[model samples]
Target: MKAVILAAGYGTRLLKDLQGADEQHLQDLTGTPKPLLPIAGFPLISYWIEALRGGQDPIDIFIITNELYQGKFKDWAKNYPFVTVISDGTSTNEERLGAVSCLQLIIEAFSIDDSLMVIGGDTLFYEDFHLQDVVEEFEVLYRGNNQANLVLSYTCKDDETKKYGIVETDESSRIRAIKEKPSPPETASRQACPCFYLFSRHTLPCVKEFLNEKKDAPIDEKDAPGHFLSWLVTRRPVFSTSIAGRFDVGNLESYRLCNKYFQENIRKLNYLQ
Candidate 1:
């Protein structure tokens, strides 16, 4: 399977938070892209590279970044010869092609016709996350039905439902509907879906279809990949696999927390070893 990493976001929020920050370590992050930002002594995206490469089966990995950060990503990618970095030709936040469109760009550019693993470059999961398990689950579902797709979900508190794309799943974990940022009373299900997805080859065409349908719609409709998945659940068998949790490095605070979590975990792991 091929993997596509969406790193095209300009990270305006994070940059804003970094401005005038007192932390000495954070000062160096002024112009860094979210994916390339240092986390636990390593570039955030390196964790993904290591995990994907560690798998027994070889997989092609592609990273999509904006023009502003293309050079940085390309330079970092030199360490991993297997990775291909593509700039979306967007120099500013306003010009970005959005996460879903970036995924489509990789699809069209590479002419990928196999199952795909799509991940948000700024997102990472807790220690319990095992890419192999998710891949195996998707493989089983795909073998049963080629139209099946998989997404990672984590339980969120009722009050936190409004901050996420809540997924309602059936007894078999097949997603019935995806409510985008609905309030507590809007849905009983507390499963919050993250940006990680495994799409079957048969379902790839639906991505283009979704884009075409939303061509004239607002950028919000096309911006987030979750919007596309919410629409896809109605037309395809999109299932959810529960994960421990996920960290989204959208702003400075979240990035700091994510970095601290990894740093602490690494220390504990080393002590045990």
Candidate 2:
């Protein structure tokens, strides 16, 4: 199996907090360019690689980050044998490509056609949850002639649901619809979509078409994956599996919360010496 991680964002919100901190500690303090943030003495992306490798099948990992951090990531991850880092180039002025577009670029660059896993660089999840199980489940669903897309869902009852892409699933565990941060009382269930997704080769063509169409369109499309996913679930089959716990380390509060959670649970993640 192959995994693609999206790490190109500038993380403007995180840098806001890091500006006042000392230059040396700034990176550790805010965890911006999230994949490079320390999780236990190692970069956050290291933990992700560990989790994916800890799964039943060995995976080839590909990371997509902006050009500036490419060297740093390469230096930090040199010891890891399976990782391959790809740079998106350094130019924030350019209207950046959305998550799916980045994935398409990686696929086209590498000529990949088998099942692929896509994840956000800044997200973390339970230590016990094996990414292999999720990948295996995707294979089962796809082999059953289900469809090309499978989204990992997490059941969050707390107030955090407002910050995520919420999902509505059918009785058989297939995703029916998804809404991004809908009004609180207007929701049907608390299951939300995390950053992890599995897709078959068939989705690539649709993604290319979507990107091309958006390029010619005048309006900017926010939440590209969600929009593409909503269409996918309606026209074809899509499956969802509930993950127990996960964290989005994109902001100050969540970054602190994730650090605390890791400290309390995963003792091995001592990032600061």
lDDT of 1 by residue, 79-155 (tens): 99999999999898888788888999999999999999999999988887878878999999999999999999999
Q: What lDDT does model 1 reach? A: 0.90
Give the candidate number with the greatest TM-score. Answer: 1
Q: Give the TM-score of candidate 1.
A: 0.97
Q: Count the backbone clashes (under 3 Å) in each candidate.
A: 0, 5
Per-candidate local distance difference test = 0.90, 0.73
In candidate 2, what are the lDDT values of residues 1-273, reduced to their tens digit? 689988877777777767655566655565347777766555788777777777656778898877767787788768887888888765462555667677777888888877778888888887656666677888887888745578888888757567777888889898888887776787877888888888876765666777676775532362346666765677667788887878877666676688777878775432221
TM-scores of all predicted structures = 0.97, 0.87
Question: Which regions of candidate 2 deviate over 4 angstroms?
Answer: 21-32, 146-148, 158-161, 217-224, 267-273
Regions of candidate 1 where Cα sits further than 4 Å from its true position: 267-273
Which candidate leads in lDDT?
1
Question: Pairs clashing in candidate 1?
Answer: none
